[model samples]
Every structure is written in structure tokens, then in C-alpha cells.
Target: MKWFFKILALSLILQSFQFSDTNESPDLITSAQLETKKLEIQNYINSFSCSESGGCNYIAFGSKPCGGPKTFLVFSNSVNLVHLQEMVKNYNEMDNLHNIQTNAISDCSVPLPPTEIKCVNGICTIIN
Candidate 1:
């Protein structure tokens, strides 16, 4: 009975060490959230620049989405096979990057507190 009590006490002590304080906060932000914020800021800056550059034509694809390579339509210049191949490769890369940026949120360590910081114009607003 005495030995059993000692074992139970030992287990409880180890368990206490394993658990962390509930009040403590995490220091990192999920990469997906960070990337999403970054993209938003980039889109905002690009729109400003586009406006300053005498405006540009913005196309809206209703039902269909913009595509590359295979379905590329040759307007005036005849599309080169090599160029098409390169476009396909670039499209794949962009797709992969999009997937990475869209993946489920996971914790990542950052230099500053994630909550207080916001990405503005591809830079952290808290620091600057």
C-alpha cells in the first residue's frame, strides 16, 4: 500500500510537469493566415499602382476562369510551342504556391507577437 502511494505520487508529479500554464499565449501565426494577409496587402498595393499608371483594363470572367498553356488562344501573334511549354510550367508553379498558401493553418514562430502585428504593403505594421 505504501509503495502504491509512492508510484501514484510520482505519476502525478510527472503529469504536472507535462502540462503547461493555460494563461500563456502562443508567439507564432499560422502560415496560411499570414500568407492570406500578405496577398491581401499585395493586391491593395497593386491596385493603387495600377490606378496611378493611367488605369488598366480589368477583365471579369463570369463563369469561366482564366487558364494557361493548353487553352491559350492566339490573338495576333502566333503562340510558340516553347512559350506554351514555359507557360504550362509557370502555371504549375503558381498552382503549387497557391496550394501551399491555402493549406490548413499550422503554427509558425515569428519574431514579434502575431496578435499585435499586421502585414501592410508586404511589411509588418507593428515594427514600422
Candidate 2:
């Protein structure tokens, strides 16, 4: 029985890796695009839905806009799809790579995008 359990565990581990999928990488941000993305996020902060959580983890150029020495906003509301995409774009520019985990998010009714994304810890999952 012990040997059976060990083999089962080993197989499970191997199978986990076998089905793992990676997301698509976006075009690297240009100096112009980076500046523009920053304004987009800044303008987005005052908007509804996206700014409800105050601000999501986002980067501008190389600056850590959220979760930095100075946080941009408080966790207020659930950030929507558009905002999520923008956040991922900035993350890539700043090299803020996310370690993908299983899809356990309750509100993530939408299918996961084939792109890298960051999550809100135990809450919303980044499906970029």
C-alpha cells in the first residue's frame, strides 16, 4: 500500500507538469507606450469598477505604481477586464511576472486568457 501511494503521488506530480499551460507574451512596451500606459492607469483610477479596489497592482515604465514604497490606492472594488489587461501590460514592461496557479477564483467565470497575469492573492485571479 505504501508503494502504491508513492507511485500515485509521483504520477500525480508528473501529470501536473504535463498539463501546465503558459500564457502569451505581449509586445514589450516602448518608451512612448510606457508613458501612455501610465496616463491610462492614472486616468482609470478615478473611474468606477477598476478603481473600486482603490488600485490594482500595476507598473508604469519601471516604476512600481502599486505595492511599492508608495501605494497608489486602497483595495476598494473588483477591477474589471479592461483594467486587468492594462495592469498585465504594465507588469510585463516592469518584468512583474506572475507565478500561475490553479483556477480557484470564484468570480472568475470568464475563461483564462492566454497571457501572463498577476492575482490578488486569495481573492481575484489574474486571467490575462
**Each prediction's RMSD to truth:** 17.9, 17.6
Cand. 1 TM to true fold:
0.22
Q: Each prediction's TM-score against the native?
A: 0.22, 0.28
- Compose the digit string of candidate 1's lDDT tens values, residues 35-71: 5654543344343322212322221111111222112
Model 2 lDDT tens row, 55-122: 33433233332322212232225546466556646544443322122111233233322243333443
**Clash-forming residue pairs, model 1:** none
| Model 2, residue 121: C-alpha shift (Å) | 27
Residue range with the least summed lDDT across 10 consecutive positions in model 1? 56-65
Q: For all candidates, what are the clash counts?
A: 0, 5
Error of 1 at 123 (Å): 20
Compared with the true structure, all predictions reach lDDT values of 0.37, 0.43
